[model samples]
Target: MYKKILVAFDGSPYSQKALTAGIELARCCGSELHVLTVVSLPEYAGTVGEVEEMVGKAQDFYRKKLEKASQQAKTRGVELKIHLLFGHIGETIIRFAQEQECDLIIAGTRGWSPLQRLLMGSVSTYIVRHAPCAVLIEKGKEEDGNG
Candidate 1:
């Protein structure tokens, strides 16, 4: 019963898997699909010009990734709205999901070890805990086959 679905995509293999799942779910439910890619800018330790150049390159990279995601959704007969966000990945995703009034949020996990997750803080974990809507995390291919 999802009317609006948001997928967090970063062009990684896991994210691509998440996109596929989101697209199929939207197709079956006839829901509006939205894809979001976030660019987490590193703390600037260089000159202003260097910071600007870094941001520019990141934007260009994300643009291409978003374009590819758009094409993939189109091929599946699903129209997708793309969003480019800058900020903390988890917070931005949760905020966008709320702002868009999304009914569901789909994301993919990198399957990190427990220690790594604890130290690095998983974005998927944060979104799962904080998202206003239902969160669907697509498991990695290895995990899917194993379990």
Candidate 2:
């Protein structure tokens, strides 16, 4: 059974799936649930003020999403702890999982093609390869409600 479960969420449909799965798993195992959303700053911001502005904007945007997710978990009788950090997606997720001592990491995938992943570098893939704990990846179901 998992003691702590971390869901890497970004408010996308794919991440929504991950959140749902994480909630279910936490409920089943009586685990602590955490949702982490990371904001990756632009490589070269013109000024430090710009970087702070970007983080502020991202916080404003993700706060609502995380709140909604918290409500969702509440309906399932699970308490959700949320974290927002600034860093590369995969690296940040891994580091947070380690720091939080998560027993499981759940993430959703966009189902990128091999070629697309090669070029774009999939975050879920990177996490799967490098995460400190066990990882679960959720993929979207087909239109027929099958996966």
Candidate 3:
């Protein structure tokens, strides 16, 4: 029933799985696929020039990520749209999905332990809690390539 679907992806292998799954879903539902990547401000020393350099690299990274995902979706015969945003990862995802009127959001989970999750705050968890639409979290494949 989905008509527009948004997927949150980073360059991680886990996020790659989410892109794949989102593509399949979009194909099945004849939905428009929107792939979102957040170019976060790196947490470190930030001189003006250094900040500019980091932002440039982040832009390039997201550019490659969106291109890769778009190519994959093209091979599957689904129309794909790319979105890039800058801010806290979770907030950016939530805002974009709302603005685009996505029917569902598909995101990848990195499988952090309870203590670690508590320390680092999970993006998937945050999106699921805050998104106005339904959300699906996909865990990346195992070493054997099984689900």
Candidate 4:
């Protein structure tokens, strides 16, 4: 049984599936549920003000997503705590999981092809390699004709 569970979300359909899975698992285990969305800071900014503006906009965007996620969990009778942070996505998620002492971390995959993942570098792969605890990656459904 998990005492604390964290779901790494990004407002995507894949992440929504992860949220649903987290909610159901939390309900079953009577665990504290947490949803985290990380906003990747720009690699280069013209000024500090520009960075601040980007962060602000990201916060606003993720806030609405988190709210919807909260509502979804509420309907499932699970209370989900939401968090938003700015950093490299994979590192931020792992750090937050460690800080929260989460027993389990759930994340969603984009179902990218091996070539795509190799070229793009996968966030889920990094988390799986570096996370402090157990990880469950929810695989996204492939679109028809892709195969």
Candidate 5:
């Protein structure tokens, strides 16, 4: 029933699995696929030049990863749109999904421990609670060798 699908990708093994799932769903539903990678800004402290350099490197890395994802989607006969964003991950993802009018959001979770999740906050959880559309969280699976 989905018309547009957005997947949060970060080049992590978990996110790669999410991409695969998103691709399959898009292929079956004939939905448009959008892959988003967000690069968090460096912590405040370093010189402006250093901060810029770090951000630049992160952007480059995400670009390459997105390119690879694009190629994979193309091979599967699915057109993919890639988005690079900088900001708080959860907020940015929710905003982007809304802006794109996506019907569903597919995201991968690292399966952090309860304590760790409590301390660091869970992006998947936040998205599930706040996203404008439906959210599917692909928990990291041990058998998939991605957990």
Candidate 6:
């Protein structure tokens, strides 16, 4: 059973699905939930201030998304905390997970076809490959009530 769950989140629907899954997992295990959003600065091609500004904007967006998720956790009475980080997404996630002593890291898979992934790579892939702890790569979408 997981004692501390670290979740990597963004504003994407995929990330939201992972967040919901993380919430349920934490609830079931009575684990402390640590939600993290990483703002990856574009490498070069911009002024320092511009890069900083973009990172700040991304952090703001992450904060808002984390707040939304917090409301859900609060309603369910689940223990949850939020963090916004500025760095390479994969590296930051692994580093934070280790620093926090998180037992598991949950993250969503981004869209990347097999060929494209071989060329450009993917974040979830990197995390799965490099993270020292357990990682769950969630990609499924929410079920429609139509069923």
| Candidate 5 global TM-score | 0.91
Tens digits of per-residue lDDT, candidate 6, 70-123, equal 988887779789888888888999999989999999888656679988998788
Model 4 segments more than 4 A misplaced? 142-147
Task: Give the Å error, residue 38, model 2.
Answer: 0.6
Q: How would you encode candidate 2's per-residue C-alpha lDDT over 23-108 as one tens digit per residue?
A: 99999999999999998998878899989999999999999999999999999999999999998999999999999899899988
User: Which of candidates 4 and 5 is the stronger one according to lDDT?
Assistant: 4
Please write out the lDDT profile of model 3 over residues 27-146, one tens digit for every residue.
999998999998777667558787788778888877887897899999999989988777789999999988889989999888778898899999999998999899999964444112
Worst 10 residues of 4 by lDDT: 138-147
- Cα distance off (Å), candidate 6, residue 25: 0.6
Model 5 regions more than 4 Å off: 43-46, 142-147
lDDT string, candidate 5, 81-144, tens digits:
9999888899999999988899999999888899999999988899999999999999975446
Ranking of predictions according to lDDT: 2, 4, 5, 1, 3, 6
Candidate 6 residue 132 Cα shift, in angstroms, is 1.2
Please give the lDDT score at residue 142 for candidate 1.
Answer: 41
| Per-model TM-score on C-alpha atoms | 0.90, 0.93, 0.90, 0.93, 0.91, 0.88
Measured over all alpha carbons after superposition, the RMSD of each candidate to the real structure, in angstroms, is: 2.8, 2.3, 2.3, 2.9, 1.9, 2.8
Error of 5 at 15 (Å): 0.6
Q: How close is candidate 2 to the true structure, as a TM-score?
A: 0.93
The superposed Cα distance between candidate 4 and the true structure at residue 80, in angstroms, equals 0.6
Which scores better on TM-score, 5 or 6?
Answer: 5
Q: Count clashing residue pairs per candidate.
A: 0, 0, 0, 0, 0, 0
Predicted candidate 1 versus true structure: per-residue lDDT over 14-116, tens digit per residue:
8888999999999999999999988786665467786677679878988988998898889989999998887778999999998889999999988889899
lDDT winner between candidates 1 and 6: 1
